[model samples]
Target: MAVASSDGEYEDDPESYHSGDSEEYQMDHRPWLERTAVKRDIQDLYTVKGLYNPSLGLYRYRVVDRLGEGTFSSVYLAYDSLHNLHNNVYWLPEETKSPVGNLCVETGHQVALKKILVTSSPERVENELSILENLRGCRNVSPLVTAFRDDDQVIIVLPFHACDDFRYFYRLMDPPKIRAYMTCLLRALKDIHARGIIHRDVKPANFLFDYESGHGVLVDFGLAERYQSPREATCQHEPATRSHLHGQRCRTDDTLTVEQAVYDARKRSRAGEGKVGFRQEDARPAVKTNRAGTRGFRAPEVLFKCPDQTVAIDVWSAGVILLSILSHKFPVFNSSDDVEALMEIAALFGRNSMQRCAMLHNRTFISNVPTLDEPPESLASLILRLNPHLYTPHQPDPTPEEALEHILAVDCALDLCAKLLHVDSTRRITAAQALRHRFLGNAEDDGPDEQLDPTEGKCGLLHRWVDGQRG
Candidate 1:
């Protein structure tokens, strides 16, 4: 974990800040002397010979403002002084030259600086860098402009988009705008998953969207991991007979559904965890590792401690995102822990569905909490109760036909949300498949999105200021 604050120095063994929202931690809660000392330390980093000195490394950055703080990292907005000169030319390699791109960055250009303590494990840092490098050319994914070390900190530079996260815009956005945002996100997921990478975190805060471009990019690869490719997963299910190895079929009894086979392969590949794998006549299921992910958005399998979990976890998180939009609630669930999260889910889905989810994970849902006899509210009923405006007409004195249209639109959205929030990971809609849902429309493409050129156009902060650069 990082020992640094957004606007000050991080305490080495500071009290846990996980009690509230990561972005909304209050500095006033600390002792006055301690707070002043940390502030001084942060200011020291901005000095001439300091970590954030305006003339360091390949680029010079003038610290602008602290953005936010997380459990282990802090973000800041900084003006890149080297890239702030509008018409200054800089030499580039022949291969890096782009005909229409600017040699110099536009004036007053800004970027988001995500800084972490260098003391963290090297593998953790390397994993993030490697993943970002692999995803460098992706259009719908957040681009890492550059990274550098300063004293005991590692700073990652990212594009500074002057827009709020998807949570803020979900309510105000119309159906078309929502469709465009979903298209960008799904395209990002598709590109990364095809490369055998799973973005374990897929909440709204990790997705930033430009209202003008209608573009959203998936960020925060901290929890990401590499996994077996689809082809590799398929090969694990092949018959092991010598004749079958030589291209001769052995038995029809070996057949398994794609989902079953994939899980079996995952269990085997991750068998190192313990004596756990696909259940046969005698062997038991694998015990999952510690919990990983946000409280509300975590999938049921994750809550049930399924070690053989797959990309379906991300799909489940995305489903929660959609549910929030439909319900007009930024956070659909705010459970204190995994157990509470499951209980909250059980409220919406009914206890029977949650029990089925537990069964799929080869676990028992034997909780002291009594199961309700009457089923909880239906998806449509819940959405209607939370956001009645969706079912009501916009005009004060509306015609009967106009109101009917509003009700139908809400129903369609509810239907899509239900499919996404399914407890069965095997039955969940994938990012690609979700794009085909009626709510998102027929166009599966995201159209033209903001792309980062490694050489000239490094960040959207520069691209947005270049004026007609994308043209």
Candidate 2:
């Protein structure tokens, strides 16, 4: 199984290839194999060779254009022939509380394939596949078409999709298009939550357009996990500033800036900070530590005391995305680490940490939170520190309907973000609650016009691992 060139020329198998050990998480997707077997017949004719890298094994792919880039993956335009790679999709079994989106399935059509770079453990890549496999039927969520050990490189196949990705969409979208896209994306989120999972990574880049031409597709579940269990949240890898930059590592030769630290802290928060869980809830388990997340999107809880929060953290990130699209600017809270992220959040929303507030209330708000990295008074000057231009007051406060619509979206999203990204898991908004928001409700009844078969079984293997406890 090596796919040759566009010339349709078959090439010899590369003699020397690395033997990749099957990851335990990947093994967990074994259940999917059984369930997916029924899908082979329908998808057999859809197979094709993938465009990127060490070709080998039972993999269908195609060569297309480049889609996007990131620290860990390279997405491209390609075709997945077998499995109706572009035309069909599936969701969880009816019994599950979660709602998954339509998987990418093209009947000899183009699709987007994200090739993850091999920088971390092989298991990490496997974990992403395992997660995607479980979420196969999740509408808008990218499906894991197939995973193969391509010599030294590991590859996962997905359907070709449109470029209305949120990150870049802002650069090109019109008002009507943005609204329509947001409506579709939010609907996807609603369906996703119905299945008991939390899309931990909900940013512009991760979210692409839906199959409905300009519509959006909710993607990038690498950081996503089910909220049914306690998760180990941390800030070890997190930087400590509020600038929109990558989090800084302690070992780096370059000095870490305050901005970088904030960015890293926010990311760490997404790594499982601001979380809480019960023993029986075997979905996500817990331990507090450090983790870094995309800047601006890092929630207040995670930034201040990561590895100590839960699903609310994702809400914060979602709000940032919503705001960015509405404002057409990079998210305002972009920070380099946790401390600064928290400071920015506090500045915007008023300094009201559940942990600190508990002291005044003499009752539990957020009983278990990470130690604060800054002082209480830092909140007042938080906005001022970040704002170097002083106050350039707008006399009329521009109210373009499109901008106002975005403002409406952001304000609504912010309330949800604040609730879901709360420091205390007890106070956070659950997935069920989020689905009911006005913004999320924008596209509720309007399912995709395309008739996609619902998913087959429960895609909870990875959810059980990342969101909850392992056996």
Candidate 3:
């Protein structure tokens, strides 16, 4: 099938075009003349013209075009011939009312084929597979259709969602539309965390949204890990350091009850009929690995080298995404390194507040990093300065004087951002809590409006810093 262009023009049939034979059809194709030692291995795989005249066993994919490329893999837009056939067939009895047994409806449709080189890290591959398996058939998340291994290659198939990155939509959509997209992202995060998994990477590029439906899906779980809930973790005395993580990975949960609970939870998740059943019950410490995350979005805990990182890291990144949209800056903080990132955050909250956050996690603040001499400005004031339109009332309103209401709305959004973007990991808002925030709309009940202090935060030290600045 030919992909339709934005102007409604159809491209040539994918099956008819051969790589290298025509220069016009070449994207991922490498000419035979340019082959080298390291390039020879991938030359044949990446140079192929769809699945025509080739063997892919039970799986068959007709390549449409190259979607993207990374160090270990190349993603292509393809039509899955095998899965499409399966999608038309009913796997279970028609009498069954629940749609849980039906194979994913997206089976035979266009998919994103991520082909990873065999020589890549197996641990990274396994981590992604495990998390995808755990989150199978989940809504608001990109579903993994199927995966198969070929000689020196691994292909993972996923549903092809027609959408653009968060950056594209944020510039085009209004505030309400942006809020809806963020809500969908938060919904996805809720399910991920409930399943005891943490998506260590959450950024604009990872979130894809369809403009018509106002729907967003979280993608790329390569940096994620299976978390041991603090409630169930037995190793409370363990330090959150790289060395301690090595020791924790060696330790195992020996309790049979813990295993059974996890099994039951997973079974329910697979069924997809009831609410997410995975809950914290075991006493295993948080897993630790190499420090990995995007530069600007990395949480202070991660920046300070804390090993026992939790879902809060993702919350911080989500907050950053929101801030970007509000401030009209695609990347609100464009920093060269960790030190620069810290300085960008410090400019808003002041160095005293940042130091208190480092102390909370038992991480040392670098002595060489410079701090601002002036007191920190509140988040609300900063946002107002960057986005004056947020406080501007719409034209032709019932009452001419509605600036107070608009100001309140801006404050509400700033309050939510402050909660999620806290330097102290423990003080960060959970995905569930964020859903109930006033900014998102309080639908459940009509309660008195609570006042949120502009400089107040979850950390006592931050409060002290705020007080000291005032004094």
The true-versus-predicted C-alpha distance at residue 257 of model 3, in Å, is 38
Model 1, span 1-471: residue lDDT tens: 123344545434343433232232235455644544444434444432233332333226655456666765777766666653333222222222453333234333556777765556768777887788777766588777778865566777776655676656788765556667777777788566544456888988788878787867888887787542221112112211111111112123323443355455446544555433324575654564546678888888788786555666777787788778767897888999877887788878775677556655555453334443345578778777888776665567778887776666566667777877788776666665666667675644433323335244222122232222321
CA-only RMSD, every prediction: 12.1, 15.7, 16.7
- Candidate 2's C-alpha runs over 4 A off are 1-60, 81-108, 165-179, 194-196, 210-214, 226-292, 306-308, 353-425, 439-471
Against the true structure, candidate 3 reaches a TM-score of 0.67
lDDT for residue 181 in candidate 3, whole number 0-100: 75
Lowest lDDT 10-mer window, candidate 2?
239-248
Top candidate on lDDT is 3
lDDT of 3 by residue, 323-392 (tens): 8877777788888887778778778777667766655544334333344535447777787688777666
Which residue runs of candidate 3 sit more than 4 Å off their true CA positions? 1-59, 87-108, 229-289, 366-375, 393-408, 441-471
* Cα lDDT computed for each candidate against the true fold: 0.60, 0.47, 0.61
Candidate 2 lDDT score at position 271 = 78
Query: What tens-digit string does per-residue lDDT give for candidate 2 at 1-471?
Result: 243555555555443222232221122333544423322321221232334333434335543334556777766555444534223433222222122233244423455666666575676676667667666555566566666664445556665554643454464554445456655565566565544455666777677664346555677776666443333212223221111011222322222343354445446554777543223656644535434467777654444444433444555566566545444466666677655665555544443453342221122222123433343443223333443222222224645764566546544544554454444434545444555656555445544322212244353522343312342
- For every model shown, the clashing-pair count is 2, 106, 4
Give the TM-scores of the predictions, in the order they appear. 0.67, 0.54, 0.67
